[model samples]
Target: MEDLVLNWDLGTGGLLLLAVAAVAVLLVLIMAFKVHAFLALMVTSIGTALAAGIPPNRLVEALGFGFNPTLGNVMLLVALGAMLGRMIEASGGAHVLSERMIQLFGERRAGLALSVASLLMGFPIFFDAGLVVMMPIIYAVARRVGGSFLSIALPSAVAFSAMHIFSPPHPGPVAASATVGADVGLVLVTGLVFALIIWGTVAPVASRLIGARIDVPVPDILGDEDEKTGFESRPKVSTIILLLLLPLVLILLNTALNTVASTTSDPDAFKATPWVAILRALGETPIALLITVFASMFVLGWGAGKSGTLVEKIADSALGPICSVVLVTGAGGMFGGVLRATGIGDAVAESLNGIGLPVIVAAFLISQIVRLAQGSATVALTTAASLMAGVVAAGDYNQMQVVALVMAMSAGSVGFSHVNDSGFWLVSRFFGMSMKQTLGSWTLIQGAMAIVGFVLSLILWAVASAL
Candidate 1:
């Protein structure tokens, strides 16, 4: 079905009200009525679509606009990550890796070790993919250390978010830089500086505070802890490290090639080279994860004397537990998609655009509002940057000022992660937190990151102006 043209325009105020109502109803259904998250999301999506003037005949199509693409992106990563994680967990690689980490970092600072690793990993990996891949290690560390799961996991989660939102090579900041004409290299350096500051200061403190109060246990999503055995047969820590690094290296290689290609005068020709194409293909997240999974089967599976049938069962077991997680995440995407399709984000952005705020402040506020409205950080960042493009071009700002604007918008795009955001569900389910716990902790963590990032950007803006 073709995209439905909205015949009846809900004024900006009306659209905003509808967006708020949709979220309210969604929360009540899940929180009060105790409805399943998937059902609540679907119901809210359908209702919101209709109320926003989507024609009845095209309702299914409108739903597909968000649902299909989200599942297409999320399913592969979640499934493959789960499979890789299962293999590692079953093979006791996670245990060995965690043991080595504790030995290296000492138990007193295991959370610090995980955070630093995650920050490094986050540089090359997207948030969801990185989080999924890191969960087994996070779980192993939390269990061995014997404390609140969030204390160990939250810092790593925030680290990934910090890198993903602020840094380059991740689509959001890169796209925003392009849209607002910021220097990509400057943005990368500035982003890394701020991302570290935000992650280092904010993540650990929030993790400890929330972890102390909430006490989310390590989830059994990969496999039961009791079922794991044969520790002596587990892969050596070096072997486990190689298995974990495979995807990261592949992904990094792909990112480097693409970056090099983009910088060449004829980017198309550079990318068209067969060698480049082949390398990029290998580096694609799904393909990279797929390669690691197969590699694990050999080194961790057959090499360990596990039968092919047993390896197959291990992979199969990973799928069943993740079905609900995948569906609910996709449904969250569906709800966000419905909101996006309704044009509420555009309505809100246009209103915010006219407010005459300073460029940096406007960038953050516009991105935040659009993100809250639509649930996609990329969409929010790009939209805010696009809206600010004319103003930025006319302003004749220095490179640092322009970079500050991009960072401010990037920060805004990350805040207020809630039910509509797919990452929220991903974190909630993977960590075994109830919806309330997720809201109380994860949401606040993200909010704090955003606020601190924005403040830091403001400082940068001031410094740039003075220089």
Candidate 2:
């Protein structure tokens, strides 16, 4: 989180061009030269940093500092979530859940059912973790229902991305709301409304339209070709649901209590209570996931009649496949970090600061630019909010207007996820999608979500301004 302390003498125009060139080179390296994504990202990061005038001594430190933080944030979640997912997959729990869903919703409506489930689950879990845990079930449903994987996967993926970008307890929106001094409750409520509306309406239509063009066969997660043994003794549906919901319920409780405590007259009194402190600690994301993983060991593994040794092997096996995912995601973060070190995001936002545009529109546009430049939505949102905060504070705005602007910034933060973005790789690798397929499907989904969310926010801002 420490800002790179180098002096950047480039103007906004110069830095913006540099950002474009960096991304173009990255694409060429990956798409044309066939460089491994990890090496390409590292090369681009170092080259970009040097091009942007980063001192040589600070170069390695800058890249490591950027790479390490992202790696730290993601590694535990990916590893633990993967273990939990593997347990569910190996024990026939995912098959059970998918079967039940297909029966209730019917094969034709399976995609809708999965998406709704993902929306509910996405409220609490981070996008990558939620997607990882849900993948087995998604795969099972796709196998049973017999259709393009995109028909099922895109809707569910959009749901997670929508919730993660817009809602609180997911860090990005929470931090942006705080920076802009918007009411957290208002932002949370507004975000949920807009996100759900878009997820229900825009995302499905977009998914169907795009899914047809991208033909991705489901990858072999459950070893479908040789899985008769595990499927013979499937776990109960109720147990599978409980295992999935446990962490979500705990995390939601933590968010609710913290919101209440923050709003109360004596915040410290709530924090000082032994039970509150303990629950908060337990509900911290890694702990919540850990608790869920342990519980899953019982509910989805041993209780399902698998041996402890088998469970250990399943969890251990999960780590091997995702090692590449973790490193490439970290390198993606490193690229973003190098861009940040060169002060590109700040320069663009600063240049956009005073152009007499509507505050909400400005927020969306600035956030979108920063997002395209850097590839981390959280960084884009927080940096844009910081740049725009003074203006929002000084303007004559009503409560809902403030909320709408926060939503606008949140929406813009999700703009156009591409090669430089880590989430791009996460989706591409997990779903067995190629780069062109990822662009046509995942990238386009993000663009649709961002634009639709922004449009909704614009309407809200206009209505609130009128009032």
Candidate 3:
């Protein structure tokens, strides 16, 4: 279902109070009381809904509205992406890629290479999924190079986080663009420019400064020891790279065609062409991933000389671990959804209009508020965009400015990931960092990236307006 259709009866003060209470209770449950994230989120959602005066009968509907859609969008990607990653890792492709990267970039630049690779892979994969897929390589590189886990891990994780937040085909910016009526092509283009600038300039610096202060031990979550089993039979680096790039190429082609088709004078011109339609379908995110998974089965499985049953077992193993990640993420979405159902985000966005800030700045602040209140960046993005849609319509922003606004909203959505965020836990568990260590590293990295992204977006907005 779409975000809750709410005609909020509560005034701004009441809604704000409820939102603060809900977030407080959620944090207390998870951080202080040590409750499982899913149960805590459910109880808090139900309590907050009642306190916010959502009718008792509609409470379940509201929870389901938030939970199911998030589960639907995320599960397929996470599951399939994990499967592909498992196959790659199990087949020793991760080792091959890391070794090749170290050779090409040398040891000093290996971390940079991994970050760049993650930036590319992040184009098609979600942040968590991309991080999972790259974990083996990060571990391999760290082991070979001999350094702090943060040195190798932070850059790659931050790269994925930046791309996921600031670019399209990752839900946040795409939904934000749609909500605010920004051109998706323009947003994608401008978002890419800003994303690269932000990640390239900011993430590495943060890795050196912040990551140096925090020490984290890399965990063997990806079954790295088993990688040696098929080391000699691993697929070539080119083959692994091809598998990784397949979805991105398809998705980009689809984006390019849709942009061209939308601009055509005759709307039906592209639709009349069967080949164009088919290509677009293939470019769809889910379809692109499905095709990539099947291709991987042949390339990484049979082509690599692994038996069919072995490949099946490998993929099966990938799913069991990610069940918590998927559920916690969905629960984070549920909390954000319940907040939306109460119209708290809307109230805050509406309040921002009289604050004398630029709309782009206002958009960023609103998104950050929603993000901090709830735990899901996607939820923060959509809720913030929904609230800003009316303001954006009235502002008459130019195309570039509109794109910048979308990026700003995206930046805000990813601003601060703390206790309530499933992503926080995922990073902590996967990288084997304590909660405090994660706060110092992953949380700091995301916060720094978000601030840098917003600043860059503001600069872009200024330049665009001046032109």
Candidate 4:
């Protein structure tokens, strides 16, 4: 079912109170007790709904109703994404790509190589995957570069965040786009613009300043053993580029072709072109991804002399984590659906309808408030998206304006990534940072990224309206 936002009977005063209560509980859990975001979100959502006097039996029924459909839509995509990412990693694609990137940048620019891997891998894979698989290489590079972990880690983190927030194939942007009816192509374009701001400008510069203060260890568990898988020093750069660029090129072509058709009236005339239509179908994300997977099987596996079993192993490896995340997110969505069914979403949305801030400003403020309190970016994103779904849908939202609305929601997601956020402690544990240091570095960088996201999205909205 679509995540529709129906109207509610919640009074403005009641909503304000509920909003405050939701914010307070989430913050208390994340910051005070340091709870896992997934748990924290479930806790706060149920807690707030109850506090709002949602009937317990009704709420439970709503939740039960929401489970399957919410999870079903995303379950396959997450699994498929995980499957694709695993094959890329296990096939020694990471090793091959890293070798080539380092060679291109030269040994002196090892930091840059680590940063680039984070960016490129991030495009097609999830953040945790990027972290788990690439961190070892990052550690090796840091040691070779003679820089502190922060130097390499900072750039790598920056790149990962950029891709996580900006790139498709990652569930966040994909779901956000699907939720709001934004064109995938437009979202991609907008996401790319925002990512550049973060990675190209904000992340690299922030790393230089922030990296100076922290020194993370490459955890022994995450460290690479010296067993030479007899992996080649480098795969052909041409082969690597072709594999890497495959999905991006396909997705972009899909977007570009759609964009081209929209700008003119002769749609079928354009579509009638055999070469264009053929490339369009072949270059679609799903087909193109399958192509890349096959390419990796041969290029990185056989080309690099890995056993055939290793190829099978790659596909099997993605299941555990992908299943966990997809299920959890599906549970979260079901939880959201219950909130909507129980009238909590509408109550929350209606309560905020008249706040003095501009719509965008209010969205950011609510997101930041919720984020600081809860520390689950996904929760923040989903919650904000659910609430705003009503507002943006009610208004005449052009395709592009949806980006601003979504970014405002995303801005909320990044606020206060302290104890509640898994990423916060992941950084703290690896970097050996005190809580205070995580706040200084990880917390600050995330907040910085979130704020910048909002500011730029606002700029885009204004420009769009004026046009």
Candidate 5:
């Protein structure tokens, strides 16, 4: 992959202030002080704008320019994702699947269900989105079958995390594939296989066994504060299953069609066929997502007999996580932009090169520092990846190795999530575990996940070198 060079001449001190200040302060406020990410993001962005020394009217312009586009582009997708998740939850789809899976796993083998759901859910949806959608199912199963939330929810989250960090179709690895000039389809296949293997070999099944001795504190994934008199009427198992798989099918089909089209030898034959053109159109990612969303609506609404009001309510419920994610992403984006603008990226690159550390190692370390200091995984991933993009542009590296590099960054981010990481608090708050218990379980879990992920990446790296 080609290294990215920052365009420094276009950036200025004021612009730098508006961008980095927002990112750094927002992260500090949330992770260090335990401030809510939503409020911290808003205030820090505003502070950044104000610090840039822009005129009041121009500051308003910057705010509008940055905020609206960020919200519109990212948040809309996030909203759709949230609604889909809620439908899966409230429509009884989640309950039915979890219930059935529990029976299949039996008490002796329930942790395996976490691995299964986590692997499937990671294909198209965000990790947190999968967690939000699947957590309730974990909790309900826990309450009904009798086990700590740790037994189910932790494994489920870990499974999803494996998919998120290691798998493709999730943003970082997907973007890394493009940045490194890899074939996307190959990465997708490879990532899924590795994700499933890691989740199986690494996830602590013994959490259930050891949990019996430890009195493992349970965390809630669904903010289901409501008391249930009886189980809500669930949508059919088939409908729930179909809706969940719909997005992935479209994406994979699109990828397959495009590969076939790319290999077409005859120009006349390629352009002449109406069927070929139609297949090309159908395979696009945005279109695939759109098709999945509309399909899910019908399956959950009409097929499942859910009312529009219920769907709307579930959508609103989905907003909390979506909003929290966007604010952090925007702040992170601004930070990346500023690092480029300020010439800090270039200086850092030169310094690393002088010290004889490879660019990938530098990128990995920078991201790790950010993650350790501030606990927002999204922020750590975005800013660090974007900054590393500069280094990626600076040197020629193997396309597949870039994927390995992304895994290193992801591994660095996962371990040692403490007071500063919002996920730490979210898990703590929802599950009602003390900070100590959270450190013991959530902290240990994250650290273990990262360690195992890094080791896997090293193995792949060695194999790539040998090849």
Candidate 6:
């Protein structure tokens, strides 16, 4: 869809105000009125488009402009990823992998072991899904190892949070990368690197310190009885590991080939080579994920003794839970399209330039504000990236710089989880922590993760600039 032709213009100041008011109204609807994010975003987008004087006839076109393109790139990846995760979770691969990690790490370092396992599992899994799958393992470890539940559980929870916030295939970073025109492959590589760095430095220390200070016992929310009863039938740990690594390896291969092609005398011709084309096609994120999902069904499903019908049902089941996530993401894109069509993005870019605010810093701050207001990292990330899409387009950023900017925004999105956030409640209830205890521990861990991630992004931005 083409940009809408404006009959009347809101000058920069007016456009900026419109943007602020739009965001404010969006926050109010989501927070105060408890409106669903999808509905809130739709209402705000339509209102903002009208308020900005978009021609009545072009309003629908303007909305679809952003929504369609974003969902086109994002929806397939999310759906495939969820299917892969469901297959692994349902096959008891998650449990078997966690048990193997504990054996290697030993009971003395069970917290670290669970954290490492969660990070690997978190690659294809959403935060909530991975957490729920691993809770039984986390609880069992806490019981056997006899430690503060926070010490055992917090690190693992943060590990999933780290991967979800920073990495690709997860809706938040994927949508943000798409909005800002960052390469998903590069985002994946950079996000994984930084997620590990931040998780390594922050999670264990913070979890142990907080766990030591406040001893919350593991709750019976997920009972310990028969925790390992069905593990004998699960896929081997090595098989599960390979399943998790398949997409990452394929995507990275694509990135590597693209890099090699870029250095050739005729980059276009290099990419057009028959073998290279075929390889790149396989390496595309969606295709890689699709291939992995099938591989998972065969390995985790049939190879593990599940019937073909059962495998089909497992994949089918994955789609229903993610429909809301898919729609909400599409709605966010619609909202972004309205901002771009109305020229609010351009106005904000010029305002940032005039105020001498660095785009990367501005990206983080804007994402943080939205995150603090609404408590959904995906919402915050998509909204902030949409707002900055114009600025990123106007700037002379290399791919690395753009990726760094996305990382910074993503870092901001994951910070400060509190009562308003569903994840906060999920953690509190699962661990049976009081409200105050959760505030002290989970919230603090998230804040630390965000700060460390942003700092690493700043360093990456500098490195990219220097290169």
RMSD of each: 1.4, 1.9, 3.3, 6.7, 6.6, 7.3
Winning model by TM-score: 1
What is the per-residue lDDT of model 4 for residues 389-449, given as tens digits with 9 covering 90 to 100? 7777888877767877777666666665664354554455445565666778888888788
lDDT of 5 by residue, 1-467 (tens): 01323223334333434344555675578668887645665566456544544445554454454345445555555556656655566556667876776777885466666657667766666665455545556665666567565665567777877777766667766665555455677677667766776677656653654355446444433335243412246667777667766666665665566556557897557745898667656644455556666676677765556676665566566677555565654543333332333343333433444565665566566555555544445545565667677666776667667666677666666766654454554455444565566667777777777677677767766676566
Candidate 6 stretches greater than 4 Å from native: 106-232, 355-467
lDDT of each: 0.91, 0.85, 0.78, 0.62, 0.58, 0.76
TM-score: the better of candidates 1 and 6:
1
The candidate 2 region of ten consecutive residues with least summed lDDT is 223-232
Off by over 4 Å in 4: 1-92, 106-109, 113-195, 205-234, 264-288, 302-308, 321-353, 358-443, 453-467
> Rank by TM-score, descending?
1, 2, 3, 5, 6, 4
For each candidate, what TM-score against the reference? 0.98, 0.95, 0.86, 0.63, 0.66, 0.64
Question: 324-387 in candidate 1: lDDT tens per residue?
Answer: 9999999999999999998888889989999899888999999999999989999899999999
Q: Which of the two, 2 or 5, has more lDDT?
A: 2
Better of 2 and 5 by TM-score: 2
Model 3 residue 97 CA deviation in Å: 1.6
lDDT of 4: 0.62
- Candidate 3 per-residue lDDT, tens place, 64-179, comes to 76678777867887787777777777777877887898898999899888899899888766787677657777887887777677788888887888888888867888888989
After superposition, the stretches of candidate 5 with alpha carbons farther than 4 Å from their true spots are: 1-35, 45-70, 181-194, 205-234, 258-350, 358-363, 366-448, 460-467
RMSD of 4: 6.7
Clashes by residue pair, model 4? 26-373, 27-373, 216-431
Q: Model 3: clashing residue pairs?
A: none
Give me candidate 1's TM-score against the actual structure: 0.98
